[model samples]
Target: MLKYQQIALEIEKHIEENELQQGDKLPVLETLMAQFNVSKSTITKSLDLLEKKGVVFQVRGSGIFVRRHKRRGYVSLLSNQGFKKDLKDFHVTSKVIEMDVRKPTQEAADNLNIGLHDDVYFIKRVRYVNGQTLCLEESFYNKSIITYLNNEIVSESIFHYIKEALGLKVGFSDMYLHVDKLNQEEAAYLGLKEGAPKLTVETIFHLTNGQPFDFSKVTYNYEQSQFFIQANNELL
Candidate 1:
């Protein structure tokens, strides 16, 4: 699975480098096989994945060509259970970009309420909805809280692991939404042009014991997604 993902990424890189363009035909399977040094099955699987993502389209008796995708729909962050539970129409998937314990940036340290010297598990993932890239999320977890995190755990739901494996009860989370511009890393992962406008959500999660254990920032492709918020009347 990981190998196929790497091949898909390399194909995306080719598109980014202008080696491919919208409506431009793709190279033959043999060409791709030699280019990536992979088997025929691997190349076919890679193209199939890209096709599902609306990155390329196939023609009967003809070659594959790039397709300009018009990504649509909305994903909710209104619940603490995560987007998968909240989304009704989309099948969500995650690609783990990196996972390692590292010194926290000042912003991450402050949000997770940890000291500068404290090391945290930094996890980065690119999330997709029915094959269309939606967002890139970077999460910082207190090592003392989720001490067993790895790439495999990240490919699944971290919230699930926190509650089920670690036996931690989530109390509440504070979320701040903002309109931001994409940075280079985010732009590349989401396949967006540099400095594209995005909707960003920053969240801090706390345990029942009042310990803040997780801090995450998720950036969404604004054109492909929307956010809905509900407000109820309360006595002041």
Candidate 2:
């Protein structure tokens, strides 16, 4: 583990052991100085690292205190190593409402590898987290494999649907992240004010059978959400 990570774990242990609580001051510099057996610079770096990760907050002179707890479990499909996550953990409700065929726009055509006016299927959804607006995801699938979308059995995560229900192999996807000013319509869907800043992630998902199958664009508030990645030395 990285030194900072080890420090983080130590602090977490302290917190778990009730040495710290919400709004409680951490040990003073002189106290930590003796406990960690490290230089002041190293200790400071570790505290700063914790502060940046939202695990701790520093008061002007009172010292650091526990702030937010780590999110705990996060899994991303592209990395392909974590346990199969149950979407229920997100505390979000997702409904895939409409799926229809439409002609691709010039930009959509380029993203999905379809002709400018070629037929494509549009999958629209509204996702909520903890009963609050979270994201609006619009997925476009290549017409060939999109026959599955014609069914009404759309579930929580589209990736899971394609892989399990249809017995399709999924792997390798490209993602693009960007920030944009939200419009009134999108903000309404997300329960945010108009012109709010939002982070958008667009992904082109490909299947292991040598085909690019899905393109999706999702918009959500960055201030309200985050992402996590886990690594293992063991080969996946």
Candidate 3:
């Protein structure tokens, strides 16, 4: 195994041995680097992978801590831009499971203002925390606006690529949040029992010009994460 993966496994073993628990702080980066005889970057990557799997979390200036399974709650959406980066306290990682160009469903076509016969980039990604799947996301992007995308960028941050590489300004998005029972595919991805309750969010993203460019549905493991909305103004 890679050094980083090895380190991640060691950390997980530490947890499994009951040496760490939720609210327990992890060793500092320097300490871990020295203990593992790995470079700082390798240690960081291992911790990052663990964080993505919901194993541990970081506090900005404080330090990393073991994440209790029940104590974990992450906001599904932050703003109109789409997909909050509030995971600063955690090591976030993702895997692009599948990517394809295909025709959209009627709803997806309408939301993205594309034709049902026109092609869209259909991307399926699983976000992990502490080696466990946290969210299963299937996103459809307008081929015209997004232009080009690959698995690498998909696994990282599509939003960042959209802004930095494509120079497209993301305007805002409309989201519908609800609870539903997990389907077969979602259950398989999240390793949840069939029919388990799932926290779901459907989103439609628009560009600065008010043109819709992306549509996505995210299914989260309710047992591992929680979601909430904060509003500054009342809706009329």
Candidate 4:
């Protein structure tokens, strides 16, 4: 008796081993049945699981193909955590360019709770996952706390250091998202053209004590990114 779970596991194993890419079709029902000795019902269940998990997509009349990987960075209320509940799930990398530390303007001072005359640490970075450019992030932090940011800080997730090293685990945040055209500087880092479609996110992360920790603006190239939001009835 071939169970659906067994079929699903086999399919999972196949995906990891094969360079099956988006648009690459998997073995059809007959091929799967012949090799796995599974019934049509079980195979159907397996395919359904893959579709729901975003691993495969079904085209009308065209059998299933590997689902193109999408990097979904939206609804990231706690991206301080990671992409998929596990830290490794995020898998994104970054290249940081340190910006000059200077007196913050009125807008910067207000956002980061600093005085207009106070110095602020500004860093720019392009974020990637799986070797693909996904985001361009400009971050501002209170220079009084963060004297400077270097390459080491840029390559890794900033939340990791703030929480584990500096003990600045954020307890809350406010985020707004929108679509916009990429400006010249932003387009350059992200390998996008000026006026390219991009996702813009303005985020304010707060410390557990209700103090602002950081303010950042992140722009994502839609072609290289995908977003996720899970709904739990109980949580709602």
Per-residue lDDT over 1-236 for candidate 4, one digit per residue giving the tens place of the 0 to 100 score: 24876778778778867757778888888898888887898788888777765667777787988864444344343355644342245566777766667777676678778788888778788777767787888888877766556678657766777766776557788888898788898888888899989889888777777777578888987786666653333346
Per-model lDDT: 0.82, 0.70, 0.82, 0.73
List ranges where model 3 is wrong by over 4 Å: 1-73, 80-84, 234-236
List, residue by residue over 1-236, the lDDT tens digit for candidate 2: 57766877798678767746567778887778678887787778888767655557777877878864345434343443212342335576666766788887676778877786767788777776667666788888887775656444544555666767887778678889899899988887787888999888888878876567778888875455556643232333
Count of clashing pairs, candidate 3: 9
Assess candidate 1 and give its lDDT.
0.82
Give per-model TM-scores.
0.66, 0.60, 0.66, 0.61
Question: Cα RMSDs of all predictions?
Answer: 15.9, 10.8, 11.2, 10.3
Give the Cα-based TM-score of candidate 1 against the true structure.
0.66
Candidate 1 Cα outliers beyond 4 Å, as residue runs: 1-73
Model 3: per-residue Cα lDDT at residue 102: 89
Runs with alpha carbons beyond 4 Å of true place in candidate 2: 1-70, 73-90, 231-236
Q: Candidate 4, which segments miss by more than 4 Å at Cα? A: 1-77, 82-91, 231-236
Clashes of each: 0, 0, 9, 3
- Residues 1-236 of candidate 3 have per-residue lDDT tens digits of 68899999899889867757778988899999999999999999998888766678778889999875443345535443333344455666788888999899998998899899988999998887767677999999999888899988887778889988999988878888899899898999999989999989899989989999999998998886765443222232
Model 1's C-alpha root-mean-square deviation from the true structure amounts to 15.9
1-236, model 1: which lDDT tens digit per residue?
A: 37877998788778857856578988878888998999989888888777765577777678878864333344445566667854646788999988999988999899888998898999999998888888899999999788889778899889999999999999888899899788898889999988999888999999998888999999998766875543322311
